[model samples]
Target: MPLSHNPNLLQPRVPILNWIADMGSDISDEIRYRLCATLASSTLPALLGSLNSFCITLLAYARLQNTILLYIALCDLIFGVMRVCATNVSWLRTVAADLVVVSGIGWATMMAATMVVVGFSDDTPMLIIVVASGLGSCAGIIARNYAAPRLALAQVIVIDASFKIPFCIHHPEFIPLILLQGAGFIGVAIWIMRQQRETTVRAIAGQIESRTQSLQDPLTGLLNRRGFAEKAQSMRQTSSTKALLYLDLDGFKQVNDRFGHGVGDEILRQAARRLSICLPNASICRMGGDEFIVLADCHSRQEAAVIGARIIQTISLPTVTSAGQASVGVSIGISLFDPMEVDLERAMVEADEALYRAKRAGRGCALLHDPAMSGASKAMA
Candidate 1:
């Protein structure tokens, strides 16, 4: 069955055309978004400079009796004005993507039409300069919208055909030059498209990596305290019953002193891995040093205790590092949330108090937060 009709394949059966179309769409969206974003940003000075150049050109061409040049310049001037006005309108900003494509096509068409008319005109110097400027503009557009391969191709084809079609019909002697120019534009567009794709992909990947680094712990590759807090807050808002488990690894300082910080870091990584395995649904965070936090959904204090117990057992297992085998136990304090009272700060304090109680009672145990534990927690502290 044809890929287009299959309802299974995402694209049409023709591989080459499908690939090109997909690439073009991706590039167009990226370039359009970037362009719109740039225009929206504080690049007004640069924009004004570009508009000034166009205005100057318009004034210079107005002296000539060429109606086509005047018309193109006037259209360009109006487009520039609209772009400046668009910055303030919410509706215009929303439709900026479509406007960009339409305006690009319009400008390309006008420039092409101007080139065609100028080639047959009596003003030799003006014709030469206009053709040269048109080619330069094509190059500039290609560079500016490098990510949008289809837009680049369309602009090039329009401009190239404008120059070639009229010259071929009127002069016929410049056929060789026209074919050469056409082939050159095609080659350059393909090359620019490939380069732009690579550049964009790398930029996106770098952004993802940077964002991930900001939120993740360097040692364990687990979410850091800030990341955990943000995620837990969101989860609390959505879920009725949730529990926050505070865990501190026992004898971590001893291991760090005896085996060096390398082994200590490995232990933290292994502990994070274990916690993730034991409580897969929980948001696990390395809350600095030997402390870790887990925010999870629970039906009652009992369910939270069960999860806490699992985490304790998993973390207590001996971790084999390059230096040697190291053992550490975890004391967990679980704070169960009442659906009516969703105070994160109070729950955290309760959990911390419970953790102190667990440490006082024994090293390797899980304790659910209780009001009476507060006095005991103060004494231990």
Candidate 2:
């Protein structure tokens, strides 16, 4: 007491020391009563969280498997009851077996108890009703995430039926309570089913939207740059050899210069449609402005050269623009990927350099990269 007369040191230790002292209290009489109160107070939120999570699970089950909506409802009621009961008594301590038993017994018992209480309210004692409901709720909470929904529901129905005969024969007045509980469970189940349907529809819609975005180009409705990269990367990784052609449209400036930007856009769209028909397996992309890239499968350098030749010939085809007949040819540079040799980006670079050579050589032809002749090209660079 003298040491604590100074407020500064005494105040700092007071709260922590009080808490520590409380933990050491003897578990008898006054201390026991306080401990029980503290435990019960803490247990309430945990119980509530369990109940909320069960409700969410029930909704998820309903949405994911619509055919088992009724089954899920019954399960939810059973597990809901088990969860409530388990708070007061730890029925399944071991993590392994506790999981299965909780779902099986807890959910089934609740449905059974509800039916008995609903049908024979007059005869069924308050103690029996409490025990059944509490045990059922605890079981549902601890059960595995996806143990058959219908089996759980069936067990509940069986239990409910078993409890009814005795109460109806001897004490008919109790029938109302049993019916009430059954009806309540059915009502909750129906609500869960409706929510499940809405969620399922929403999920399906989201998937469709995601697929559309993946396949489509955001600005052009043709396949995007991302779509091209994925296809090219996959083929290069799996196959023996392939080719990439980089094309930058020559005389595209004339369209933008004479007719303005809008006509230039229409020209690009028309170019995409016409180009897509030229090669079946090839992927084409607009790499900003008038630049485009094409990737095609090939077994040898000769096959790749043939594809590049076909592309150059196709681009030279006539198109009727606002400035009368606009014949726009492309300068194409070819780069080939070797399974044991070149990397992905290096192949594109070689193709790009070849493209610049074509442009310098009067922009209508295709140029392929040859490592043997690269020293000469390097000197020019």
Task: Note each model's CA RMSD in angstroms.
Answer: 8.2, 20.5
Off by over 4 Å in 1: 1-140, 185-208, 229-241, 254-260, 298-302, 323-325, 337-347, 370-381
List TM-score per model, in order.
0.63, 0.52
In terms of lDDT, model 1 sits at 0.68
Model 2 lDDT tens row, 1-381: 211121111111334322321322222333333322332232344345345434533543444433343454566556655544433344322221233234344444534433444334442344264346544543442232112223333443455455555565776798898789766764554445345434543555566678769866665556677777776666655656777778888888987788788777767776777678887777787777877787777787778768877776787787777666666777788877774477768877888888888888878777778788852222111
Q: Where does candidate 1 clash, by residue pair?
A: none
Over the stretch 1-381, how does candidate 1's per-residue lDDT look in tens digits?
221122212122445433322334443434434433432342254244335435534644664666666777777666555545444445554444444455555666767766676666666676676677677767766666555467667877887787678668877898898789789878977798678666875676567678789889988989997787677667654746888888999999999999999899899989988988888888888889999888888887667767877887799899999997999998888787863576777878888888988998877888887666543332222
